[model samples]
Target: GGSPALGTRLKYQRARWERKRSRTAKELLETEYKYLEQLDLVLTYFVTILKAKGTLKPAVLETIFGPLESLYSASHVLSLHLEKGNLGAGLENFCQSLDLYGHYAENLEHFFCSLKGISLFCCTQEQVRKNKSFRRFKKLQETRPQFQGRVLEDLLCLPLQRLHQENSLQLLRVQKLLKGQKTQVLTPGRWYIREGWLLVVPSKGEELKRRMFFLFSDILIAAKPCHPLHPLNSNKLSCQAVYPLQQCSVDKVFGHTWSQGGLLSVSLPTLMQVLFLSWHGVSCTHWSYRLLVTSLSSGKEAPLGL
Candidate 1:
């Protein structure tokens, strides 16, 4: 049997852990309520008004707000579950609805791409300000008690950042792995596009090297797993290179002999360098599409090679 002092210490630690868990659950519930309100603002004030007034075409609106209605519904149900004081049920509800988040994340690049195209073509701030519908909406937003002076941009950005926050646990792990590396920090307005393992093929008959790639709105980062021999760097990733999307062009390699995979050639004409990346299965096509969409959204022209 344990001594009285040991039992007391164990009880104290368990109580502390319980308090921390309780606090975290409460915080999650509170944030969910606020998040639901923001979603409501977008859906009610902006999306509904835009549709009712015929401000944008149906296809354009779909591109700009992919699966937002479904996301709002899922979030509403999750919030209701959380409000019922059952944290376990709330988590279960979220797990059942996880696909909604994945769908939103996958289509996020398209949303920004469509928004950028619109901005470049006809929806500049000056033009929007002069539009009758926008003026009316602006006035309504200003006077609406629920809006609380928040603009459309703020509400629109909420969904984008919500995914980033959802992935905070993975990011925390990444932070620990990159503790000593000089890595570019993720900043607001820079949206994550995609990430995956890829093979780097060399020009000569050299062996293929495996690399991890992270695609963002403006840049692509390639990293390599650190050597296992170094205890401090075990299971860590070391940054290999960062490529600016504006300076790069991607082309699909034709007539590849690989039975189950495809290749992409990322070229930097200014630097006279090309990176041959091989990806397995159908994900190659998906990554190529996302890269093009993200590059265009970042103000770069679509690659002529494509």
Candidate 2:
């Protein structure tokens, strides 16, 4: 296409101009350092005004400028290495500089979400391209033809990947937290409750109904059985109990039952010993059930209560 041909011609012209501007990498690096000094003067002027007006809090100012200091230091070191013809050291410093920028990008997004973030964003968008530090980096890279294609592109874009990976890890932690906050172990069972017969029948009526209980890391929940008996039928399970385990201490747990009630009882540790039902006719034995609780609660470690 004509556009591709035009782009190639423009690129060649840009390369020629760049070569005329700086004969070698050292020259380019030196030029960048000089430009940075000019930038520092301008930045210092603005910072002084901001400080005089009391617009910049000490902590906020540190947060904003700490990364910039590191970035500048890295660039200066890289330039020194370049001047000394230390390519190895210069490349090492270059990668470190990129990593520092990645760290800065990660923090910058967080900063932008803060109180004065929007104004900063607008100011930077308006003035950042004109920034000497930015132009310096662009010029240095432009002069180096070896730093073309995927090699340089990926190195420059390392910050975006770092941001994405950090965000993904945060999201993963949130999901794990949400999952841990809820009940994990659920068992479908039955509970026998005595029911009195009608007065006309004149007989004691006893019935057993399907009951289910869920054991969470923090609380225990009693629920009614499902109609269709689907394992994942959440809608069918009606809430019957919600006992917070933190307040209650395990008192007695009975595994064997002789046609009579032999369920686990928990005594709430308070001014008065409040008794709460723990389990009756669970599928697992008392010790096995306790192990399950330990595994779920990670050895009685209470949930964060968040």
Candidate 3:
């Protein structure tokens, strides 16, 4: 072709911009990788030098920096993905590390924030390319499938939307719980308590193979899980509203005055259910019930109902 059309030129420009952005992000990630390497080396030498001079005990040094060891390993893994241009995987790892910030012995939220800021910058750059619109060309080219796919890939990797520490009440392994309509047979499962919902599934099964039961703060659902042996199109469990929690009654029974082991009974319009939780000490049970009650009460005004 003698010259490309306006749309074609726009597409080329967009692609070029994206490639440039990716390159910049890769450079930033590499810089971070090198910094971390140097930091580790410096830390090792400093510790070694101190120990040799008898200025610092090896145990004291370990006590101080042991937690950082995990952070270093996690960061190294992220850098490896970024260096390989695996942005999708890197982003997922970055998001998951958000949970680890709380676990750091020394506060490292600011460091993680810098990493997030850089990642966001790269994402914004790519987004600008995706949204590069030519107002003159009314019939602009459709969005590239690759860009759409990338968006979807990131979406799936993201944590549960609107889920925060305040909203994520508790996660417990329920030795057994009721499942399905007839309330047939007790089941051992996992219960994930969130601001306004619960995700329940068998504790021992693979994630995809197990069907999820959702109990929103306001409602209860009953449905058959997809058969683990012969799932249809990777069948997903659907929730049906049975009754509103607003009209339901909740009764908690404890083993002792300050009971740790207890049963939380929820009476709905059409059904009654009890969740039993016990730990080595009654304190564990007490906390679980307290958290459950708190989650339920707060869910009434929860910003995200689901």
Clashes of 3: 1
If scored against the real structure, what TM-score would every candidate get? 0.50, 0.28, 0.29
The true-versus-predicted C-alpha distance at residue 287 of model 3, in Å, is: 31
Clash numbers, per candidate = 0, 0, 1
Residue 163 in model 1: shift from native, Å?
5.7
Task: Give the clashing residue pairs of candidate 2, or none.
Answer: none
Alpha-carbon deviation at 288 in model 1, angstroms: 1.0
Candidate 1, superposed: residue stretches over 4 Å from native: 1-176, 257-260, 300-306
RMSD for each of the candidates: 11.9, 25.6, 21.5
Over 241-306, each residue of candidate 2 has an lDDT whose tens digit, in order, gives: 455655656533455352333434444455343222323333223323442343345333322111
RMSD of 1: 11.9
**lDDT agreement with native, every candidate:** 0.62, 0.41, 0.39
* TM-score of model number 1: 0.50
lDDT of 3 by residue, 1-306 (tens): 224564464455445534643664476486656546544542454434445655334544343233444555666776788788765456445444544434441222322224333432231334323433411111121133323323221221122221232123221111122222343112222223321222322235534221223343444434333222233311222333344555656555544333534444555566545342333344334334434553465444432221
User: Model 3 segments beyond 4 Å from truth?
Assistant: 1-7, 46-63, 105-306
Worst lDDT run of 10 residues, candidate 2, spans 190-199
- Model 3, residue pairs in steric clash: 260-282
Q: Report residue 190 deviation for candidate 3 (angstroms).
A: 34
Q: Number of clashes in model 2?
A: 0
